[model samples]
Target: MSESSDLVMPDAADSERAAEAALRPRHLEDFVGQPVVREQLSLVLEAAISRGNVPDHVLLSGPPGLGKTTLSMIIANEVGGSLRLTSGPAIQKPGDLAAVLSSLQEGDILFIDEIHRLARTAEEMLYLAMEDFRVDVMVGKGPGATSIPLPLPPFTVVGATTRAGLLPAPLRDRFGFTGHLEYYDDDELATIVVRNAVKLGADLTQDAANEIASRSRGTPRIANRLLRRVQDWAQVKGNGKLDLSAARAALDVFEVDQRGLDRLDRAVLEAVCVRFGGGPVGLTTLAVSVGEEPETVESVAEPYLVREGFLVRTPRGRAATALTWQHLGMAPPEQSDTLFT
Candidate 1:
């Protein structure tokens, strides 16, 4: 495995720092997509910095790879504040959180990614730290123990979560502003591709940018990745300029269809339409039927499927839509209830 993959899934703090260092968006303008989030955050940061106080705790909720981490860094930069990275899962003990909290400077931004996974004890301590800028730290062993009252600097906590619904009500309510990041539109993703291409010093055309954007699965990171791959293809197979035809050919070779469905994406649809007769099936059943991980099916495959109207999420489970049948060159069943309704 790669060094990054073998890092034993370090605590949220280390993971957040690595993510910040590796893919931190350098400037507000360079941060791609989620324009509303940018505008809202800009207002909050400007207002807070103008008043010379840490901004209200910010809760950023979104699916993975939609720039939640990047936005957190951008907020820190905009406020001229240092960011201390951490996550919910990393905080195994209240003391772990107290150590981090006690070290923070006034007006510093503490970014907690995956905030939903925090330990219960740590979460309780954080409630006090967040609300009153103080943490009661336990000293020595149990029974004959002492609890030291430690005061923390006034710091802004920015929490990012893939599953915001899992966060407790008290924790969620503490944040003054909540920004929900949505998937990028194709145009926004195209702009993201073009921007990264310029940064990477690749020659990219408008049509090529659009083609790449269309197949980026509506994510800036994916758009950037695709751009890098296409650049490599251009270097070997054609002139270094990424023209539309070259982009299409490169993406085809990568098994990325024009509709943005990848090999695994097609596999899910194929399993449903071909194997399960266009399932109105449970997620576990579908996962087992397709021989893939259930989380992968829910996280990666289902997002695109629902976005493209090929799959529907019902109380009963996941079911293929009429669009799925049409896309797979099969007819919709007669006398069937509409999937969306």
Candidate 2:
């Protein structure tokens, strides 16, 4: 049996990584969903190109798998510039950041994923680089240390973060534009699944596409993953046809329910409802009850539950809504109203 962690987690496996790369949209026009963001970003890039100047710093904030990294690459493409991909965690110090910043060629787009997690010193260094296109490099050591100003070529910083709230205001304000990506609707995910099916050279029916999309938790990455799984099941168990039956059978084997709830998601709801009397329970306590890390529960499970109207996060604690009771086939207590109120 697969570990419980494998059920709903969105992390891509090694094999899936190559598939994702191949399915990625090369240009902004080919990208799926986020219409408002796409339009605004197009304007930003177009305006910059017309003026013959690098575009203003941009921040793309959204949940994982919603295509922030892809959009960053598109930004570079739209402006006809090269892209430098890095992550906040990889920059451990100011010097580390300086190396990347100083090496940027003119019109390059520096895409820093999880920008909110950047080290304080590196973040501070970025402020000057973003604003003035220069960095004060430290020379010598100790008391005799001198600062040398290094001029950087004009470039754009495209920052992507899942937690925009964690970024300091100064850092956040450095970006001239911030695009907040929301979860894709079922139709959008369906389109993404169909596109990926074509790319994978798999025969997928419309009903099967809808089935995978509806159970993808409003994520393109999950939709593609489910599509691949269904395709595999069709090849092995069926007559190599991706139809509704194949999709349903594959999802059932993977323990993904009709509403996209996996084992871990159900566990969270069960823990809150049955184990805690429908839970005005704290996140830490709830995570402990489910035998999962608090961060995992908070970041992964809770977002979808709350978005689906199955759970609510209050100042007090995490609580299951009435819909959660119905989904689990349970009756709410007589005092359940007061419990949430």
lDDT by candidate, in order shown: 0.85, 0.91
Q: Estimate each model's TM-score.
A: 0.88, 0.92
Best by lDDT: 2
Instruction: Give the per-residue Cα lDDT of candidate 2 at 61.
Output: 95
- Model 1 clashing residue pairs (backbone): none
Per residue, candidate 1 scores C-alpha lDDT tens digits across 178-279 of 999998899998877777777678899999999999988888778777887899899999898899999999999899987889888888888877766666
Which ten-residue region of model 1 has the weakest summed lDDT? 332-341
**Alpha-carbon lDDT of model 2:** 0.91
The number of the candidate with the highest TM-score is: 2
Candidate 1 Cα deviation (angstroms), residue 46: 1.1
lDDT score of residue 151 within candidate 1: 89
